[model samples]
Target: MTEVVHYALVIAHAIESLPLSRAKRQLLSKITDLDIAGRINGFGGCIAKNKTLGEEVGLAETTV
Candidate 1:
Protein backbone atom coordinates (compact mmCIF):
# COMPACT_ATOMS: atom_id res chain seq x y z
CA MET A 1 0.00 0.00 0.00
CA THR A 2 2.81 2.39 0.81
CA GLU A 3 4.55 1.66 -2.48
CA VAL A 4 1.30 2.02 -4.39
CA VAL A 5 0.62 5.40 -2.81
CA HIS A 6 4.15 6.52 -3.55
CA TYR A 7 3.82 5.46 -7.18
CA ALA A 8 0.54 7.28 -7.53
CA LEU A 9 2.10 10.45 -6.12
CA VAL A 10 4.99 10.19 -8.59
CA ILE A 11 2.60 9.77 -11.50
CA ALA A 12 0.57 12.74 -10.35
CA HIS A 13 3.67 14.87 -10.18
CA ALA A 14 4.61 13.82 -13.70
CA ILE A 15 1.15 14.68 -14.95
CA GLU A 16 1.30 18.10 -13.33
CA SER A 17 4.56 18.85 -15.13
CA LEU A 18 3.19 18.01 -18.56
CA PRO A 19 1.97 20.71 -20.98
CA LEU A 20 -1.63 19.58 -21.08
CA SER A 21 -4.76 21.57 -21.79
CA ARG A 22 -6.99 22.56 -18.87
CA ALA A 23 -9.70 20.11 -19.90
CA LYS A 24 -7.21 17.29 -20.24
CA ARG A 25 -5.72 18.02 -16.86
CA GLN A 26 -9.16 18.08 -15.27
CA LEU A 27 -10.03 14.77 -16.88
CA LEU A 28 -6.84 13.18 -15.57
CA SER A 29 -7.55 14.61 -12.13
CA LYS A 30 -11.02 13.08 -12.14
CA ILE A 31 -9.59 9.72 -13.17
CA THR A 32 -7.06 9.89 -10.32
CA ASP A 33 -9.84 10.76 -7.87
CA LEU A 34 -11.91 7.77 -8.96
CA ASP A 35 -8.93 5.45 -8.63
CA ILE A 36 -8.20 6.71 -5.12
CA ALA A 37 -11.86 6.28 -4.17
CA GLY A 38 -11.83 2.70 -5.41
CA ARG A 39 -8.72 1.92 -3.39
CA ILE A 40 -10.26 3.44 -0.24
CA ASN A 41 -13.45 1.43 -0.73
CA GLY A 42 -11.43 -1.78 -1.06
CA PHE A 43 -9.45 -0.93 2.06
CA GLY A 44 -12.71 -0.28 3.90
CA GLY A 45 -13.96 -3.73 2.89
CA CYS A 46 -10.80 -5.28 4.33
CA ILE A 47 -11.44 -3.51 7.60
CA ALA A 48 -15.03 -4.72 7.57
CA LYS A 49 -13.66 -8.25 7.35
CA ASN A 50 -11.87 -7.60 10.70
CA LYS A 51 -8.37 -7.52 9.26
CA THR A 52 -5.95 -5.49 11.35
CA LEU A 53 -3.29 -3.14 9.94
CA GLY A 54 -0.55 -5.32 11.43
CA GLU A 55 -1.87 -8.34 9.54
CA GLU A 56 -1.99 -6.33 6.36
CA VAL A 57 1.59 -5.15 6.86
CA GLY A 58 2.77 -8.72 7.57
CA LEU A 59 1.04 -9.95 4.43
CA ALA A 60 2.72 -7.25 2.37
CA GLU A 61 6.10 -8.01 3.83
CA THR A 62 5.75 -11.71 3.11
CA THR A 63 4.73 -11.02 -0.49
CA VAL A 64 7.76 -8.80 -0.95
Candidate 2:
Protein backbone atom coordinates (compact mmCIF):
# COMPACT_ATOMS: atom_id res chain seq x y z
CA MET A 1 0.00 0.00 0.00
CA THR A 2 0.95 3.64 -0.18
CA GLU A 3 1.75 3.59 3.50
CA VAL A 4 4.16 0.72 3.16
CA VAL A 5 5.91 2.27 0.18
CA HIS A 6 6.22 5.63 1.89
CA TYR A 7 7.52 4.02 5.05
CA ALA A 8 9.89 1.86 3.07
CA LEU A 9 11.26 4.81 1.15
CA VAL A 10 11.69 6.76 4.37
CA ILE A 11 13.49 3.87 5.99
CA ALA A 12 15.64 3.52 2.93
CA HIS A 13 16.56 7.20 2.91
CA ALA A 14 17.32 7.27 6.60
CA ILE A 15 19.77 4.45 6.17
CA GLU A 16 21.17 5.68 2.86
CA SER A 17 24.46 6.10 4.69
CA LEU A 18 25.11 2.40 4.28
CA PRO A 19 25.69 0.76 0.94
CA LEU A 20 23.33 -2.18 0.60
CA SER A 21 21.53 -4.30 -1.98
CA ARG A 22 17.94 -3.40 -2.63
CA ALA A 23 16.41 -6.61 -1.26
CA LYS A 24 18.71 -6.85 1.72
CA ARG A 25 18.39 -3.17 2.42
CA GLN A 26 14.64 -3.48 2.40
CA LEU A 27 14.88 -6.29 4.90
CA LEU A 28 16.99 -4.08 7.10
CA SER A 29 14.53 -1.22 6.80
CA LYS A 30 12.64 -0.10 9.91
CA ILE A 31 9.40 -0.35 7.98
CA THR A 32 7.99 -3.43 9.59
CA ASP A 33 4.50 -3.92 10.91
CA LEU A 34 5.59 -3.56 14.52
CA ASP A 35 7.57 -0.40 13.98
CA ILE A 36 5.14 1.21 11.57
CA ALA A 37 2.26 0.36 13.87
CA GLY A 38 4.11 1.87 16.78
CA ARG A 39 4.66 4.98 14.73
CA ILE A 40 0.96 5.20 13.93
CA ASN A 41 0.06 4.74 17.55
CA GLY A 42 2.73 7.09 18.75
CA PHE A 43 1.14 10.05 16.97
CA GLY A 44 -2.27 9.39 18.50
CA GLY A 45 -3.03 6.97 15.67
CA CYS A 46 -3.59 9.39 12.80
CA ILE A 47 -1.30 7.79 10.25
CA ALA A 48 -2.07 4.38 8.86
CA LYS A 49 -5.52 4.80 10.30
CA ASN A 50 -8.26 4.09 7.76
CA LYS A 51 -7.49 0.53 6.69
CA THR A 52 -5.86 -2.27 8.59
CA LEU A 53 -2.23 -2.77 7.61
CA GLY A 54 -3.11 -6.01 5.84
CA GLU A 55 -5.90 -4.43 3.87
CA GLU A 56 -3.77 -1.47 2.96
CA VAL A 57 -0.85 -3.60 1.87
CA GLY A 58 -0.81 -2.32 -1.72
CA LEU A 59 -3.17 0.61 -1.95
CA ALA A 60 -2.40 4.20 -2.86
CA GLU A 61 -4.17 5.79 0.11
CA THR A 62 -2.68 3.44 2.64
CA THR A 63 -0.15 5.42 4.64
CA VAL A 64 0.74 8.79 6.16
Candidate 2 residue lDDT tens string, 1-64: 3544233213445645678765444443433544655554554223434344334443333331
Worst 10-residue lDDT window for candidate 1 reads: 45-54
Which lDDT tens digits does candidate 1 get at residues 1-64?
A: 3543412222547657779875556555544555555556554222212133224333332322
Candidates in order have lDDT scores of 0.44, 0.43
For model 1 the TM-score comes to 0.44
Each model's TM-score, in the order given? 0.44, 0.29
Off by over 4 Å in 1: 1-12, 43-64
Q: After aligning candidate 2 to the native by TM-score, how far in Å is the CA of 12 from where it should be?
A: 7.6
The lowest-lDDT stretch of 10 consecutive residues in candidate 2 is 1-10
